[model samples]
Target chain A: MVTRPPVIAEWLVRQTAPADMREALLGDLCEEFVLRGSPGGRRWYWKQALVSAAQWVPASLLLLLPGYLLPLWLLDRLWALLLSSIPLKEDAVRAWPMLAINLVVACLLGAAVRLPSGALVLGAAVLILAASVRLPLDYCCLFLVLPALASKWPARKVKRV
Target chain B: MKEYLGEFEQLVMLALLRLGDSAYGMSVRREIEARTGRDIAIGAVYATLDRLEGKGMVASKTGEATEDRGGRAKRMFLPTAAGLSALQASREAVARMSQGLELEGLVW
Candidate 1:
């Protein structure tokens, strides 16, 4: 059996100072560490962000990619008209534009997941654009609803015996 | 009254007191771990030592670079008069707190 390091817990505890002034000091240190992205702390943040992106990319590809692609694949004539109606000719427009939009949306989604408050403003902008385009309600809802629902689920709940 | 030294601070000071002129980061860390069975992180130990030195409770000087530590110079520490006094006062306080308590047969 492997014995736990005696000082490991203490060191971890010391990392998060007391509930008094020291707590504020440690908080400041953490904030500075994040902002500076120093060698000591940046690796952990990068690892976490990459893990979050790994979860997010697959989900976005599954959910949004199908919706975005199915319109072009199944309703090719209607999709051409939709593109032409936006004041851009079908042939003048390239698949690159749609891909670019998807990439931007993915980046925005990643940012929203990482920073919720900032993402709220971006979400509002997307909602306005979606409304202008008269896009399906579910499309608009996907951006706002999913994130809100995910945020509401408590990580751990306590129950009284 | 002087503020109470934290447990890690107390440990580092005590190690310096015991090691006298030979107190350095690795040696002091090893000494504390041997005595207390606490495997402290090197970063935490160095940070605490920096704080203690800042408070003038300990004094440190850079020694010659060594091969084992990637050719890094060792920072040797020695307890100041204030450190010794602080350690003595902390010990006395603990002793006073336990003076009347019969802890012999207690589970604690």
Candidate 2:
């Protein structure tokens, strides 16, 4: 017996087109796939990724500017200290190279927000946060909050008079 | 006024006619694939169908959902009078264009 109609699969594949139009279709597919594959795991992954990205990126960078700055500065200092402790330390190493690299990466990540590949960047950030962080809850919060807010922020509509 | 249909649009309308009143998104898609052996996208079919419907060449209604389709109602299509006329005109045009063509020496 022929199982499900070939058309359904063909239809689903066709939905992945027009480049711009593919995101919503793919998003829905991803959602459905996750729901079917592992409901609990998907829920946790979404909670961490979407929810945290939405929260942290804005709350830290935009809303609480000073608070965010303090934490980032501290983190940078700690990273510098950790790097300094390594045996291959030279004066050039302790200089502005690490800070410049961080800045460049941050800029690239920000620029990626406008591209279609932003999803990949967001996914990577979520995965990195999830794996490396000690406080799972905080990482999850940041991952979910930042991307969600960034993605959904309403574009300013120009009134065509 | 003969509005030119794209190749895919022609294929879809022809498929719908062949499918009769049973023509819907999934069925039409399957018919096209089976007949033409072309892998078509579902979004393209729906989008084109919606355009054709807007042009008054086709009409559609939502049909009962089935268990296998995740409870999604199928959108059924039927060719309007204009649609049939368009198909006939397109067929005649193609026939007229290829009338005297000789393919004996052409590579098979």
Candidate 3:
């Protein structure tokens, strides 16, 4: 009986890896996994895969910055315009517009980038923004959840491979 | 001014020189680990290789797929003449820095 590396761990590495290097990288990991043997091999594989995936995060987050920041700035301007026309005395009600705009922009950016790390960064940014505006903890989570879901949006262009 | 190899880059290029034809990612990584006893990340290995290739210090080709590797082709790498020069330059620089230092048993 042949033992296999953990499937989900392999899938995560494949999904997160840059396209050009994917084949060779996965092949190396697979070969090393076999040589390392079972149980401990799985752990080692997971550790390597996770570390590799993490290296992509800083680049992905940097790529996402302009996409996230510009829209957020525009949304802030629109929210200011709306606040002038709509008067809300309660602090809770005042926080709602800020939270809503943050969620909307983060989701849009997350969908546009289509990278898992992009989604995570945008989601975390939204959560932080929501919390700053004093939204309830339950509502703050929505700021995180929506962008992650929106990250699965349909691709605008089909990849050649 | 001539560019010199960093410590890890020198190690990698030397490994390539030692490995000759069989120098691919896994083999190079294992060679470094065996000699240095350092736990090197595969991603770091590839990233360095890519950078070295970009600088024309290294070249690579795709080798045949193998069953042990789940039918994924290996990327074989070899040092260029430029790579050898850079490695030599780095070694000379280190030697110059250490010249006439009366430090015995400094190496751990």
Candidate 4:
């Protein structure tokens, strides 16, 4: 009888794992899961999944940090420049451009970090985090949606062979 | 002077040496856990393996896929000459540091 590991756990591992090592890592986990049997194996699988996600998520975040932040900074400067030139007050009325800028940045960042196993979830989480601090409802929704949309483009794919 | 291997890297290399042809992720993790009684994560093993490979201290080959592993191929690793020498240097460095040293509660 073939005993399988937890589906969600396996998916988590597959999603967050570095592409180059994903196959071997998954194989190791599966083999071990079989060896340990179902009772304790399921729990062990979840533990490994969490541990692996912990390792990869931090590394991915660090690598994507500059990719995400630099664009935001540049666009913020541009927004400031626009406000200064147009004689517009830096109030809610003037904030629409900032929202637009954030959406563009979010899309670029999502594309930059998109992985094979649906890592747009990570992008969405990051966007929501940024949104939580300063964005209003409409801006937050756009921030959330744009990344998920941009992640679909095949041009910016980052998968390994 | 050769660069010294970190403690975990040394363990991974030693495990590779012990496993010989079967020095893949699962076996390596099991070998270390059985001997050291430390619960080693497979992810940690692969990360260290990748780092070792990056440093040219190890080389790996993609092995045949097995049904037990859901048809996923094994990536087998072996320590390089540099890895062996680095492990030796690390061991010697520790041994030299501990030479003729005795703690208050322990006898040599």
Using DockQ as the measure, which candidate wins? 4
Q: Model 2 chain B: which ten-residue window has the lowest total lDDT? A: B65-74
Tens-digit per-residue lDDT, B1-108, candidate 2? 976667788999999989987777656767998988986655567657766776888876656655444455556788888878887888788889889998789895
lDDT of 4 by residue, A8-120 (tens): 99988876776667888999899999999977998899999998788877776564455554565567678878876786555636545577666666566656666233355
**Model 1 CA deviation exceeding 4 Å by range:** A1-161
At residue B4, candidate 3 shows an lDDT of 99
What TM-score fits each model? 0.41, 0.43, 0.67, 0.78
| Sort by DockQ, top down from the best | 4, 3, 2, 1
Better of 1 and 4 by DockQ: 4
Q: DockQ values for all predictions?
A: 0.02, 0.06, 0.29, 0.43
Candidate 3 per-residue C-alpha lDDT over A8-73 given as tens digits, one digit per residue, 9 for 90 to 100? 888767655554566798899989998888877898889888887787645645654555545655
Question: Candidate 2, residue B69: CA error in Å?
Answer: 1.3
lDDT for B8 in candidate 1 is: 85
Considering just the first chain, candidate 4 attains a TM-score of 0.62
RMSD of 1: 17.9
Q: Which candidate is the best by lDDT?
A: 4
Which ranges of candidate 2 are over 4 A from the true structure? A1-161
- TM-score for chain A in each prediction: 0.29, 0.25, 0.56, 0.62
Compute the lDDT of residue A123 as modeled in candidate 3.
57
